[model samples]
Every structure is written in structure tokens, then in C-alpha cells.
Target: MLRRAPRECGSWWWDLDDVTETGLVPALGTAARMAAVLGKHALLEPSSLEWDWFERGRGGLGVHTRLGLMGSRLDDPELAEQARACRPVGHPAAEMSALLVTGPGERLDAEGEPRREPRLVELTVSPDPYGCWAEVAVHHDVWSPCDFGGEPHPAVHANNAPRLAAALRALDALLGVPGEPGEPTYFGVAEGHGLKAPELVDGLGPDLTDLL
Candidate 1:
């Protein structure tokens, strides 16, 4: 089983308010384009989508929905309609909030064998009319220079960080908007197209295994 961090190690956000329209259809379109770039880099394959519903003034209704792709691509013309049809009958006024795109992501294991890990890279897009944005986040330590135990893992970092950076660069080019580094966490921080190196202490990075 894959060990996932309780919170994201690093995240990147893209404000698409100017470039993309805000709505279910347009959000899905953006997700399709973003997923394509991630898939090309073996980051996310987009097998399903999950979201919560909210009303303009009433806030969240605590209602959540999940839709399995069942081999349907995110770009499929029918996907947006299928998603819209899932709205709760009790909350007709509710609108979709941020939609989460999930799928198996490729990760090299202890022996360097590629393994499919679910939710390896999480992608979310907000369809709110007020403002539109998208975010990509990673939890595992593969993108970092050291493991949770403060042990250096240059090989793992080399193999994974570049792929994630390339994917982010591709996403920037595709969306025509540069990604902004998200907030820092105890685990790590996002810098440029990759993670910012944690401050070292006596030649070792911070031991974050306690949080893990």
C-alpha cells in the first residue's frame, strides 16, 4: 500500500478567471486539458470526479457526489451533462463547487518498479461564477530531496521531481497562466515548478516522520 501524507507536501494554483469561463462545462473542459498534460507525464489518469454542492448565500449543504468515469474521458461531450444530472433532488439550488479529478498515478517503488497509486496527484477546479481557479497538489515525499525520516533520496527525487515540474510547465503553457506556489506546510513548500528544498540541519533535512 502507498503511504500518503495527511496533507499536501506542496501545491500549485492557477487562477483561470480571465482565461476560462466559470461553469460546469467550462470547468470540465479545463480539467480535460489539465488531465491530458498530467497523463502525458504519468501523473494522473483521471478515472473519476468528486465534488460538493453549495448554494450562493446558504453555504455548503454537506452534500457530496462522486462519479466514476467508467472509461469515459474527461473531454467526452456527455460528461458535463452526466455530472449535472447528479445534482441532489433535495437541493435544487445547489451548484457544483470545486470538482476533484482522481486517478491512478505512476510511482516507482522500493525496487524502482512503477506502481499505480490512487490519488497520487490530486487536481481540483472551481466552477464558481465569482472566481475560477485550479490547483494541483502532491503528498508523497518522492518530489522532495529527502524522505520523511530525513534521509536523502536523490535517486527518487531525480526520477519524480523533473516529471512533476515538466507537467506543471506544460499546464502553464496549455492554460496560458503561470502557476503560483501554494502555502507552506510542515512537510514542504512549492517553489517555481517544484518543491522548495527544506532547510537542512547538520546535513539532514527535517524529520517529518512524526507527522507522517
Candidate 2:
């Protein structure tokens, strides 16, 4: 199933489980599609993540590093090169285990130079066996002030809430299961206002792209 937490810093998470090997490919394909849907606003790039839950006890050791393929498709061969770059020569375990797609809100070139107006829209998706999930963060260094401490005002969520809701709805239809919200984290909130679930569509058409 798939579930989501509340929106914090315009970032939220969706979790899914019991994913089959056959189903994993399709799930990623849909993710690629949804990424494309939001591509015009931001550029999605592949990343490498190292998760060692036992390293820091409860805090744990988590490392997220952007890898390769600035604008390449999910199937691009350069992805392999990028993946190889993620792992050090003698440390295979350091290789990235999670498949991450991150879209920065700022308009920048492949060389990381600014080129356009800043939209403050960032999106990320990591599809892996651990727990498939996506995140959306908006605004600049400062995020909306909505937290458990108080109610979220409309102005606070004016920029990214609707877009996040739309993305969640799209993801729901693609996954074929309704997900539940998970525990809250500093990066993701467990409660949100004006959030809506995606309507169940009748048919699963040819929306799948980047099939493995």
C-alpha cells in the first residue's frame, strides 16, 4: 500500500509495501512519468543515498549525494556510469542502494549555474526495497511556518500544497493502492491541511514510461 505524511517545508513522503519484482518496474515507470509531468518547473536528476540505520543509534547514519545524468532518461546508459561513480573503488558497500530522483526548485544549468527565476519547488523520489517514497519541498531557505505547534494558514501553503496534492493523486493511481501516512520526520510532517487523495481511475492505460 501507499501512504503519506503531512507537508513540512513543502516536503511530504509516500510509503508503499509488498511490492513484487514484476511490480517494481512498473512502479518506477510511473514515477518517471510523474517526474516528467513536473519537469517543466524543475529538472529531475538521479542521486545516490547510503543508509546505515545502525551507525548512529536512533539518529543513524544517512547520506544523500546527488550522482549523475543531469537530464538523461531513467534508462540512459550514463546512469550506470553515474552509479559507478557513486561507489569508491575498494568499497562496494558504499555504493548507492536507493534509486533517487531529485528536482531542485532553482533554475540552474547542468554546471550548477543559475539561469532563470527561482520557483522554490523541489521534488524527490526514492524507489527501493527499503520503502518506496517521494518528497516535495518548496520555498527557499525558509519554509512555511505550519507545524504541530499551530494550524496552517492558507498563505503558508500558497506555493506548493496544491502541486503536492496533485502529485500524490497521480502517484496513487499509478501504484494501484492507497497508502497511509507514516510517522513524521524533520523532513516530512505527519499532518497536513487541504490534502486530498487521488481519485481511482478506471483504467491503467499506457502511462508507463521508462520500463525496465
For residues 47-163, could you state the per-residue lDDT of candidate 2 as single tens digits?
322222222123323544555445566545555455546544444445333454544443332244544333344444454445566554443212222422233433434544444
Among these predictions, the greatest lDDT belongs to 1
Model 1: per-residue Cα lDDT at residue 75: 67
Name the lDDT of candidate 2. Answer: 0.41
Using all chains and alpha carbons, the TM-scores for the candidates as numbered come to 0.95, 0.50
Q: Which pairs clash (backbone N, Cα, C closer than 3 Å) in model 2?
A: 2-179, 2-180, 3-179, 3-180, 4-181, 6-189, 11-136
Question: Which pairs of residues have clashing backbones in candidate 1?
Answer: none
Error of 2 at 129 (Å): 5.6
lDDT of 1 by residue, 176-207 (tens): 99999999998889999999988888989999
lDDT of 2 at 56: 18
Against the reference, the lDDT scores of all candidates come to 0.91, 0.41
Which predicted model would earn the best TM-score?
1
* Model 1 TM-score, 2 decimals: 0.95
